[model samples]
Target: MTLTALRRDAPSGKADWLVIFLHGYGSNGADLMTFADYWQGSMPNVAFVAPDGLHEAKDGGFRWIGKRPAGDPKLYDDAVEAAPDLHAFIDGELSRVGLDASRLALVGFSQGTVMALHLGLRREVAPAALLGYSGGLVGADRLSAEVTSKPPVMLVHGEQDQLAPLYGMMMSVKAMSEAGIVCQGVPLAGLGHAVNAEALIYGARFLLSAFAFREKHGV
Candidate 1:
């Protein structure tokens, strides 16, 4: 299935890096595409794409898979079942742009975060980085066996998040770290299950560092 996306080309009219935004469940691509506008000033060489989820949520927007609550044991199975389609989408986009994994970064929010961590970790070639907000990892028990890459990761969660609490993020980070993944976790005090200005700043910085442009003549 072809996933429709909103794209923003590099400000310089040429591109070197790609940042794919995956919105939370019940949210659409248009919702997160706004970040492109906010970030283009700092990442003029990076292209941004935000795609609608693979399936429509029963209540409203979209989903990467069947709708399920956070921390559900079945989420691992669901993510596994749903991964191929997302993988295809990412791979297809990368191939279309003539870019390789080194130039790619996946930024995910909520359920999108699950997809980013899962697929990013298993890529045959590691993405430049993975950034997740308000989301936790799934399939932790199987990560050791399934993981193929150890790309650096930055995860931010609201300390007071009720839906997917800070504990979940901590656990996820712990597991990834145990597996030798370089991971950073930011727990925003009193923040909820939503992104805040601070998180956005951190995310932007993470992307900049992850996708920094290195001129051929200089270090």
Candidate 2:
């Protein structure tokens, strides 16, 4: 599966780190790329890439996999089938940009968060960090049996999120912790089903700490 990506190259002309942003359902790469501006100064040597999901939705949005609120087995199977393609796309992006997997991080929102957690856990070479907002672990029951990587994860969700409830976030943290993967979760009070300024700041700090980039560069 060939995925479309929007890239923000490092201003320093050398990227020591790479961040791949995955947007929420019904959104595209352009939506998440906007955050790059805020992160650029703090991570001048890091490149950002946001990729559009594979399937187009009726509301002019995209999805990595079809939704099935009824807990349909087929939909879950489709998501599993789609995972390899998404993983391949990541590999292709890394090769194209001349960056290895070690310097990379995965960030996602909502449905994209599902993809990030699912794929990032199974990757042969784990990413430096995984940051997810308004999302939970899909196929959580099978995570222990399937997980290959144990990278640190930071989960952020709004306490008032009706779309993907706060409980999901709590459950995800618990499951990941039991799986022996380092995990942190923050629930922003009175917030809704979207990323907030606080989430971004926390996410940035998590990424910086995971990669040790701030300390290395004296930032």
Candidate 3:
């Protein structure tokens, strides 16, 4: 499936990095594209692309997968099945921008975070980093067998998140650690289920650091 996207070209004209920002459920690509404005200055050579998820929401937005009714295995399976199309969208964006997967990063929020981890882990050539805010891994149990490339991941969640909850971050970190993936979690105190200014700044720094490390080692 071809997903809609908002692209922000790098100011440098020669993009050394690509950021695929995935927005949460009931939101569109434009929702997360604003982050490009805040982050582009720090990494002039980086371009940003925020893609809309597959399904349209009832309230005039979009969703990667249908929401499960609490604990439905079928709902979870649907999410797993939908992941490939999202992965394909990422690949298409990279190819269109003339960028390699190694120089790419995946950033997401809430439901988008679930999609990011689901697809990012299974990528043939993993992204430089996967930075998620207010989100968690969807299929943690199958990560070890399904994941081919293990990219560095940073998860930032609010301590008092009611929507996704802080435990989601913990579960994701634990799963990634068991899979031998480098992962870190940052907790924002007195915060809710939303991205804050501090989270955005932290994400920018993490992306920059991950790319710099990759460059230093020639990966």
Candidate 4:
């Protein structure tokens, strides 16, 4: 299925880099476009895109997995099921933007974070960075065997997030390290299941640093 998206061209009229925002469960691409609005000034040459998930959520909006929550035990299976459609979307979007996977940063929120972690490492060419918010890695158990590339990752999570807490983020950090992926975990104090302005700043810096590193190394 072809995923629909909201896009923003670089202010400088040069798409030197790409930033794709993957919104949370029950959220649409338009919701995450705010990031583009806030980031456009600082990243004048970076184009942005936010894609809607293929599956529609029951309450409203869209989701990467099935409409309902499928507990932790099957979370991996759920992500696996959602993979191909998202992969196709990412691949198609990159091609359309005249960029490769390495020139992109996958910025995910909640369930979108799960997709970023799952697909970033598995892609044929690694993304410049994976910046995830309020969502930890899914399919962690299968990562060691399935991981194909190592990319820098920044996981921003609420310290008190009941849905996907800081502990889960720590676990994800461990999983990334075990798979040879470089991951940085940022735990926001007193926040819960959401992204705030500070977290957005960190995400922006992470993307800038990751892309700079990739270019410095000539990757």
Clashes of 1: 0
Model 1: weakest 10-residue lDDT segment is 210-219
Clashing pairs in 2: none
lDDT of each: 0.87, 0.85, 0.85, 0.85
TM-score of each: 0.94, 0.93, 0.95, 0.95
List ranges where model 4 is wrong by over 4 Å: 67-71
Model 3, 143-198: lDDT tens digits are 78888989999999999998787987998899999999999999999989888799
Which is the better candidate, 2 or 4, if ranked by TM-score?
A: 4
Worst 10 residues of 4 by lDDT: 66-75
Off by over 4 Å in 1: 213-219
Name the top lDDT candidate: 1
Which digits, one per residue and each the tens of the lDDT, describe model 1 over residues 1-219? 899898888899878888899998899999888877778898888888899999899889899865677778788888888889888998888887778767789999999999999989998888888999999799898888889988889999999898888898999999999999989999999899998888999999987776653222211
Q: Which is the leading candidate under TM-score?
A: 4
Better of 3 and 4 by TM-score: 4
Query: Could you give the candidate ranking by TM-score, starting with the highest?
Result: 4, 3, 1, 2
